[model samples]
Target: MGEADRIITLPAKLATALHGIAPGLITDTLAFANRFLPDPGGIGEQQMDGKNSETYLSNSLLARLTDEAAEANNEIG
Candidate 1:
């Protein structure tokens, strides 16, 4: 299936694979990001006044890995 179909329909399987791996990765990832200003692209909301640490990391980490995988798949194909 194409990437679009995977994105729309693959979450159940993806979640099963990714569920246990996310906690440690997310903890480390946010700790790493907190050293500096958050990226505009890293966060969902552009305003980003700084009260939303969990939301920031949640959106950023999901986005980072998803984009990375998509890029890798594009290269492979």
Candidate 2:
């Protein structure tokens, strides 16, 4: 499964940590993106084109630091 699928299947706590993307909503978005009808918004189009989201996430330094912290937590605990 891809990232979306993984996110969709995650438990509530992890999903919350992943920006409050409830499992149901993520699964629904994936389903909508794959359906035959035209998408209500540009979501499917953006997914198809694989463009970056307009909602900028974090600067490279911050993201790297976060990743490193997660990795350390996983390894140590």
The TM-score leader among the candidates is: 1
> How do the residues 17-56 of candidate 2 rate in per-residue lDDT, one tens digit apiece?
6545466787787688789654355574344432243323
RMSD of each: 13.6, 12.5
Which ten contiguous residues of candidate 1 have the minimum total lDDT?
49-58
Candidate 1 contains a number of clashing pairs equal to 0
The stretch of ten residues in a row with the least summed lDDT in candidate 2 is 47-56
* Residue 13 C-alpha lDDT in model 2: 43
Estimate candidate 2's alpha-carbon lDDT, on a 0 to 1 scale: 0.57
- lDDT (C-alpha, whole model) for all candidates: 0.60, 0.57
Q: lDDT, candidate 1, residue 35? A: 77
